[model samples]
Target chain A: MSEFDLIRRSQEVICAPGARYRAQCVLGIGDDGAVLELPPERQVVVCTDTLVEGVHFPLDTGPAAVGHKALAVNLSDLAAMGAEPAWFFLALTLPAAAPAWLEPFAQGMARLASAASIWLAGGDVAAGPLNVCITALGLVDKGRALTRSGARPGDLVAISGRPGAAAHALALLQAGRVPDARELAALEFPQPRLELGLALRGLATACIDLSDGLLADLGHILEASGAGAELELGRLPCAESLAGLPEPERWRLQLAGGDDYELCFTLPAARAGELDALQRRCGLELTVIGRITAQAGLTLRAPDGSPYRAERAGFDHFGGYRGEGSPAAS
Target chain B: MSEFDLIRRSQEVICAPGARYRAQCVLGIGDDGAVLELPPERQVVVCTDTLVEGVHFPLDTGPAAVGHKALAVNLSDLAAMGAEPAWFFLALTLPAAAPAWLEPFAQGMARLASAASIWLAGGDVAAGPLNVCITALGLVDKGRALTRSGARPGDLVAISGRPGAAAHALALLQAGRVPDARELAALEFPQPRLELGLALRGLATACIDLSDGLLADLGHILEASGAGAELELGRLPCAESLAGLPEPERWRLQLAGGDDYELCFTLPAARAGELDALQRRCGLELTVIGRITAQAGLTLRAPDGSPYRAERAGFDHFGGYRGEGSPAAS
Candidate 1:
C-alpha cells in the first residue's frame, strides 16, 4: 500500500467514532493537525516518549506489542502525573509500509485506546528504521496535578501494582526462556494505572512511574522534592513469577528492573488510611514500602533494620554514576 | 555526559525563562510531563513529525539544522491549520549523547522557539539511531481553524513564499554540488509561514503545507475537499535560485520537490482580495497559482492555455501512483 493508503487504513482502524475520548477532539486524524478543547479550569498534561526497535524491543517482537507499548509508556507518564488520558499523537517510522505489520499495530493501539478512552489525534509516518514516538495529552483539574516535587518529609512512599514484572519478563525472553502467560502479558501489554492516578490527584504528595527501575525513578522524586527515602527491602512487592526465584534474584528484579509501568507515589501519614479504600475501590494492589525523610539521599533498609547497599542504581541510558544503594545492578 | 547530565544541559539551553511562550507552560523539563493551560474559548491544535538522520537530513547535516527542521516541519503543519504556534514536545533519539551535538541542536531549537514564541514542553531521550520527533501545539479561535476539506469551486489556490527552494537545495546537495548560501539556508532552516497562516484563518477555504512538493501536497487539499484544481504554470512561484536551472529541472523542483515548508491555501473568489493586502502587510510572496474546480481531478494549464503533463506526482515514500502533470521526474 502507498503511504497515504497505509495512513488511511491505520486511521480507519484506530479512529472509530463514538469512542469516549472522541468528544474532546474537535478534529482528528485527517486534518493538518488535531484540534482539542479542554473544559474550562482544567490544565493539559503532555508527555512524549520514543521507542526504537532494537533498543526498546526485541526484533522479533510483534508489531501489536510494539504499538501497544509505545502508547502504554506515554500513558504511564500521564498516570504518574495524576492526569486522565485523553488524546495522543503518533509519529511512526517504518522501513516500509507493510500492511501485515500496520494492521495488527493499529488494532493493538485501538484496543488500548478504547479501554483508556484516549483518541489517536494526529501523526506523521516516514520511511526510516522502525521507531514509534508518541506524545500523549491528558487533563487534570487546575492545580490538582501530581508532581515529583510535592513529596514532604514523613510522607509514606507507596507503589501500585507489581513492579519489575516486565523487566523480569524481558530478561527471561533474552535468556531464551518461555515465560508464563502472565509474564508475557506483563511484558507486552502492561497496563497504566490511570484510575489510581486520578484518585491520587488530591491525595498523593508526589508520584512517578516505574520505567527506569524503582530505585532510580524514585531517586528522581527525591531529587526533585529535596527529600530522602528509606525503602524497606522486605516490603518491596515482587511479581508472582519471581516468587520462585532466589532472594537475591528477586531483590534485583524488584529494585533494578525497568518497564514495570507501575505508579510509585507518596502519601502523608494522615492519608495513609486511604490506601486500603483506594486499593479495594480500584481493584489494584497498593503497597507501602518506604518513607520520605528530611535527609537528602536514598537508603535501602533490610528487614534486620540495617542499611543495605547495592552495586549500582537504576538503568541509565548513558551509564552514569549510580546513587548509593541504587538497585541499578542486576 | 551521562543521560541525566545531558538532559539537564539541554533543559538549561532550551528552557531559559522570560521566553514569551514559557508562560503558557506551567511546569516543564524536569517533570515526567509538561503542564499547559489554554485560555477559554480557544482550541488546541496539535501535529507531530519525525526526522530520521539519513532519510530527512544528510548524515553530515549539522545538529542545529536537524533540530530546526524537526520543529519547523511540525510548525508548518500548525501553519497549515491556521493556528498560532504555542508549544512543542521533543523526543530525541541518539546513538550517543554527544554534548557537541546536543548543545548545537538545543541551541537551534531554542532560537526557533524563541522566534515563534513556542515553548519546549516535555520529552524523552533514549539511545538509538539518531532521530528527532517533534509534536507541536498551537491554538486557534473556536470554529475558525483552516482545513483541507473546506475548498469550493471557484476558490483561488494560492501559495505563500517560494514553494520549491528547499527541494531544489536538496537536489543540489544530493548531486555533491555546493549550493548558494540562500539555497542552503532554505534547506536547513526553512521558516514556517505562521503569520500568513494566522491571517488566513477565516479567509482561506482550504490550506496545506507543501512538504511533499506542490502538486502532491496540493492534491491532498483537492482530494479532501472533493474538488479539482487547474494550475496556471506561469503563475506558480519559483525560487530565484532556480532561475538558472533548465526549464524541466525548474518545473520538477517546483512541482515534485518536497520539504518546502511553504503554505498552499485556497481563497474563495469573494475573499481573494485579502491576499494582496496580507502579502503587503506580512512582506511575504503570495501568488495565485490555480483555481479550485468542480471537476474531480487535478489538471495543469500552460501559459498558452493548453494541457500539460508530467512523468510523476510528488515525492512518495511508497512510490505509488502520481497524479498526472506532477513534475516528479528530474
Candidate 2:
C-alpha cells in the first residue's frame, strides 16, 4: 500500500486496456507526464477537480473512498458534457508518508477508473493537508459536444437518476442516523453515471452534473442557456431519508441539497418519447420535473401546486456548517 | 476581482488562438466540467500538480506568480514526454474569499498558459487551507514518447540552460536577499523548455525535467533507464548565484537545489552533430554535463580526475530540510 505500490497497481489496471490513445501516448502512468499523440485533426479535452481534507470529505474518511470519489467526480463532469472517459492525471497530497493509505487509495482509484475505462496517465505527489486533484480527458465526435448554452425555451428538463439520494445520505451521516459502515459508504462514495452521459450525446440539448443540489445545479443550466426554468418540487426524486422528512424541510432539502452527481439535461418536448425509451433501456428512472422557460429566473412549485421559494442555497465549502459542512445544505 | 470575475478573466486570456485541442474539446472554460471529443484512434495525456500555501509558496506570494508557477510546474512534466500542449484544468482552495488576490492570480495563470499555447478548459472553486492544483493535457506523436527507460551506457548526457538558479533563488529568498529584477525573474517564474523537448524528440535517448534538483532527478534516470552516469563537474554549467556564494555552499545549492525547470536528457554520442545543430537552430545552449557509464551508479569527476561525491539526496517535498508535516509533502 505504499505510494509506489499504489502507482504500480494503478498502471496495471487503468493503463492496460485503453489502446485507442496508444498512437500519441509515448510514456503513460509511470512518468512525470503522460505523453499524448496529437494528430493533425484531433483535439483534446481537459478538466480538473480537487477533493480536500475536511472539505470534500469528513476528517476521518478512508483513503480508498477518497481516491475513488476523486476520480468519480472528475468523470461526472465529463459525463455532463457527453464526453467519453479516456485518460486522467492525479495530483495527490498526503498528511504523511503512509504506505497503507496510499495502497488502498490507489486500488480504489484504479478500480473505478478501470470500470470507467479511463487510461492512467501521469501526475505529481506532494506532502500537504490531505488533498487529491484529478485532471481528466476524454474524446468525442468533433463539434458534437452537448453544451449548457444549447437549450431552448421549450426544452423539457430531465435528470438521469434519483436526485436527492446523495444529499439524504449526507444528512443521515451527519445526523449519525446511519452506522459507521453505511454512513461511510454513503458519504464517501457516490456513483458517477458515465454511461448515461455518453449515451446522451445527440439526445441532450444541454447537460450539467448535479454537484450542487437540484435547484442550484439547474440554475447553472438556466443561466448558461440564457433561459429561466420552472421545476415541480413534488416531482423531484428523493431517497427514503428525504421522503421521510417533513414536507417543508424535505422540499427544501431536495431543492438546495448538493453532491448528487446525477446528470441533468434539457431536450425539446418532441424528444420526450426518445428520452422515455432511453430510460427504459438504461433501467434508470428519468425525471421530468422542470422545463426551460422564457422567463428570467428559476421558479419552484410544490406537489400541491403551491409556489416554492428559492429561499435556500446549495452547499458552500466556505459557508460554515458543523460536521463537514451541512448535510442539509448539500 | 472576485473569484467569479477572476475566472472570467482567465477564460478570456487563457483561451487563445491556434488551439490544437479544438476537436476533442466540446466545452472549455465556464462549465462544471469540460467535454472532450474522444476519437477512436487518439490517446490523451493527462497530468496534475498542486501548490500549497506556506509549502510551495510564502503566504504573501503574489497571486499571479503563484498561479503561473502552479500551471508551469505541471506543464514541465508534459514537456518531459514531448507532449503537445492542449488543455488545462485548475482546482483552487482559499482561506477566505479575496477579490483582489484572485484577480492577479488569474492574470498570472492566464499569462503563462497563453505563452504555452494552452487553454484553461475548466476548474473547481472551493474554500480550505489555500492550495492550487493544476492539471494539464498535451498530445504527442503516436508511440513516440520519450521516457526515462530509453537511455543506454553510451548515451551522451545533456541539459537545456543552466541549473540551480531556482534553488539559489529559494536560498536568497529564505535569507531575505533580494536580487535585482533580472536575477529575481528566474526565481519568481521558471520556464519549462517545451520547444527543446519537442525538438529533442528524435535526438534524446531519455528526458526529464529538473524539478527535484539535478543529482536526485538524475537518479530517476539511472533507476528507470538502468544505466550509470559519469558527470564532469568541470563541464557542469554554473549560474551567477553559484559564483556569488561561498564555493561549497554554492555548488551544493547548484547540484542539489530544486525548481530549475531545465531539461536533463541523454542521447547517443553519434547524434552529437545533430544535437549541436538543433541547439544552434533553436538559439539554445546545449552543454555536455556527463556521459552514461556502463557501471550502475553516478560518479562526479573534477578537472584533476579525482572522484567527487554527490549529495545523496536533493530537495524532497516530504523528507527534505523542511520541518514536520508540510502539506506540500505527499
Q: Which candidate tops lDDT? A: 1
Q: What share of the true interface contacts does candidate 1 keep?
A: 0.84
Model 2 chain A weakest 10-residue run by lDDT: A321-330
RMSD versus native structure for model 2? 4.7
- In the range B1-330, model 2's lDDT, one tens digit per residue, is 344444666566656565666555666676766755545454455667789887777666788889789988888887887877788777888877676777688778878887888877788777778889987777665666678888899899998888877777676778887766655667668787888888888888899888877877777788788788888878878786567666557657767777887889999998877877888886878898899877787777876899876544476665654222211122
Docking category for candidate 2? Answer: acceptable
lDDT digits (tens) for residues B1-330 of candidate 1: 777887788777876454566777888888889999788999999999889988889999998998889988989899999998888888888989888888899999888887887877787888888889989999988988999899999999999887778888888889999889999999999898898898898789899998888888888888888888888888977789998887667877888887889899998888777777999987898999989889877788878898877556787667643555533121
Give model 1's docking category. high
Q: List candidate 2 stretches off by more than 4 Å.
A: A1-6, A9-26, A37-44, A175-184, A316-330, B1-6, B16-26, B35-45, B176-180, B244-247, B274-277, B321-330
lDDT (Cα, tens digit) per residue for candidate 2, span A1-330: 444544565566546364455444556666777656544444344567788788777777787888889998888888887777767777777776676777688778878876787777677667678888888776666666667788789999998766666666666667777644533454567778777887888888988888877766776677777788878877777765455678777766666766768889998899888876788776778888888889767777778888766556566554532122222132
For A77-160, candidate 1 gives per-residue lDDT tens digits of 999999988888889988999899999999998888888888888888888889899999998889888999999999999999
Each prediction's TM-score against the native? 0.96, 0.89
Error of 2 at B221 (Å): 2.2
Error of 1 at B187 (Å): 1.0
